[model samples]
Target: MKTIAILVFTAFLMISCTSKSNKIIAQKDYDKYMEIKDNKSKDFAQNEINFWQAKYDKAPNQTSYLSQLASNYSKLFENTGDVKYLYKVEALLLQVNKEYKYTAVGPIRSLGRNYISQHRFREALVLANKALAIGEGMKETQKLLFDVNMELGNYAEAEKNLKYLTNKTDFDYLIRVSKWNDHLGDLKTAITFMEKAKEIAVINDNKSLKIWTFSNLGDLNGHDGNIQKSYDYYLKTLAIEPNNSYALKGIAWIAFSNEKDTKEATRIIDNISKRHHTPDFYLLKAQIAEYENNQALKSKNLSEYFNMLNTINYGAMYNKYNTLIYADDKNTAAKALEIAKIEIDHRPTPDSYDLLAWSYYNLGDSKKALEIEQKYVVGKSFEPKLNYHLATIYKANNMMAKVAPIKKELLKSTFELGPTLEKKITNL
Candidate 1:
């Protein structure tokens, strides 16, 4: 039986903060259980602000109050997809760090988490190391360190830290285990870990935890070729947080890829784009319009996506997407190469290397691309997306013989690869 791992925190919310029953039911029942109070009237962030603000007013210098306030802002950022809350979190944490002499482990961990959210892995690593050095938050700090090392492509170090952190059966341990297995391309094991984590979260009656786990389960199931399960899980997530952008995006993908309903997909994504203001949603719109051969719609959505990217000035946060966009177009090849180099300098992970190699490939340097692929990407990753890129890179270099094995592996997960891409793999 495939275990449904509970969705846990995103990498951004994985630090210092933070389930029970196992009852299998039908999809309809699952949706019913997922239904909860409508979240729109909750004003959860404002409530948090009121509580923390009152506490802070009582004692302006209290590091504890300030730390809680920073955490609240972090949640607010996640809730609203707004950078202003992130700015508040950073400032509050910095104030706490200075006032507490950098010895306050909680504030340091929280600040490090904020940095991680912003994709500043190196800075987060520095703080993680400091927390570890002071012997504060050893387990949580070590977890943060593990995550940072993974982002930076220090896989060996990440594994060592992961081993140390996986000795417990808590939510953190299970979720991290799930993520580790996922990274190693063991989707089954990852889902098992997530299921256990989700079970615990449910038993504990943690709404946020449930929302995270359900959303993740939906994605995992979708990636594992179980469309109904994925759709159900996404519904469950929406039931908890009606305006969840992540859940909305997942639903949109299911509609487009599995259901082949581009109209529904467009509607879902448009809702997400209006609510979340995320540039990637516009990219999805572009893809849908491309499939329909609506060049005008595609151009409009692509322009909107780029406009959003430009407005955000997201820096490294947008590096991966920017590299993809640049690599796909000859006019942007040089810029893609530039972004790829910066990404490799920052992370050097297999994914980053893949992007760098792809940039080279797009620039007509197949030999350079092949070298990068062999050294960093080929055997290091199990992601079908990267494998497809590898096969294409080999084909570009006239290494037709080398492409067969990758095509074979990719064909095994046709459903996960989606119909459009499945057709491409068949041709390959």
Candidate 2:
């Protein structure tokens, strides 16, 4: 039982915000929820985020307004694929609970999403339980509870919630079950679940669920090392939502990983670049330039990346490009250093600690990197990327004797690449 994201705009709008002007602003954002659908609109969501952030400053503990604001931040987090703001959102929700007598399911669902983001499946399950206990008659949020349980490796609980998904107003209910089934380690079962959702989305022409299902299938293929199949799935996804910048990035990476066709990869990369300003697009340009052996262009683009990471406070935007989009380990080290400074200074969380560790590891500071990595690895399972870095650092420090067990584990991971993952095995 996967939980559909019910924006709950109307319900949230009712309790939060008293000022007519602020309500008007929230209405403006709600309009876009229905009208806008493109990666280009990522920044537009940011603008709404800014609006809510400003409102938060003016009225700090106003539960209604802050709850509304938290929702917007959650949206930004989803778009950027960064989770730091999740910790921030959790903090805000706690504040909401403190200020208002009641705890709402919206904030709980948002936090569960964050836990899911971090891959802290068990923790997410616990929080989802809290949300379910507090939310009466909110079937969607209850489904979210079931979703987290499924993610937590509890298949039976997810199956129990199937009855609530019957003929949902939105087909996301079906899609959620499919993903939960996928996580349960039964590919055949997962496909059967998704087939029902796909059938409904196709019949109704639900763009959101159509794109969602296709992208998911693409990831499943990629995990199995079926690169061409994954590539074709991604192509199908883009046909549904041509401006889904994330999918565009995915296809470019597939081209790079499978074909290494500079022209084809660069074309996809350029597609992401044409969208609204993102620190990532510039980084992609740098990567394209590097692939072309255009030293001057590469240097220029890298310089922009440096500026964005150092000078600009793109917040999640900086991390989106520097942290998530790029594949070059060494270059990521530089960007990570800049990101660490900002994150640790302006805010701090497990992710910031991990970023600093990766930067230090890349810059040859094994001792510092090891210390920070040790602190971060507790919650690091949510982040397989960090495990790769840790393996690299351990091997470099003559700790292969300690790394062998982890290497064996990595070799069998769902995300493993044959030779690519082999490179991490110490003493192999």
Off by over 4 Å in 1: 1-42, 412-423
lDDT of 1 by residue, 1-428 (tens): 01112111121111100000122223353333223344462377778888989988988866788777777776666765666677789899999999989997878888887777667888988998999999966888778887778778898898888887756688887877887888887888988998998998899998888887888887777556566676688788877777776776666665565556787667666655554566667777776777777889988988987897778665567778779888989989999999999888888899899998999989999899999999999778877768888898898888889899888887765544554566788777
lDDT value, candidate 1, whole model: 0.73
TM-score of each: 0.88, 0.54
RMSD to the true structure for each prediction, in A, is: 6.1, 12.6
Instruction: Determine which window of 10 residues in candidate 2 has minimal summed lDDT.
Output: 9-18
Which candidate's TM-score is highest?
1
Candidate 2 similarity to native, TM-score: 0.54
Q: Write the per-residue lDDT of candidate 2 for residues 1-428, one digit (tens) a residue.
A: 11232211111110110011111111221222222345554566678778877887887755677777667666565555344555667677767756654466766666676556544555566767776777564676657766665444345666777666676545666666666655544555656666676677778897767776666666655554455555566677766655555555555555443444556655655554544334555655665576566889987887776775676443342452354323246655676687666555432445556667767877778888888877765433433445566777777777887577666655554232322333444334
Can you list the residue pairs that collide in candidate 2? Answer: 16-64
Q: Which whole-number lDDT from 0 to 100 does residue 332 have in model 1?
A: 91
**Stretches > 4 Å off in candidate 2:** 1-134, 142-196, 203-205, 288-296, 306-313, 320-356, 360-384, 401-428
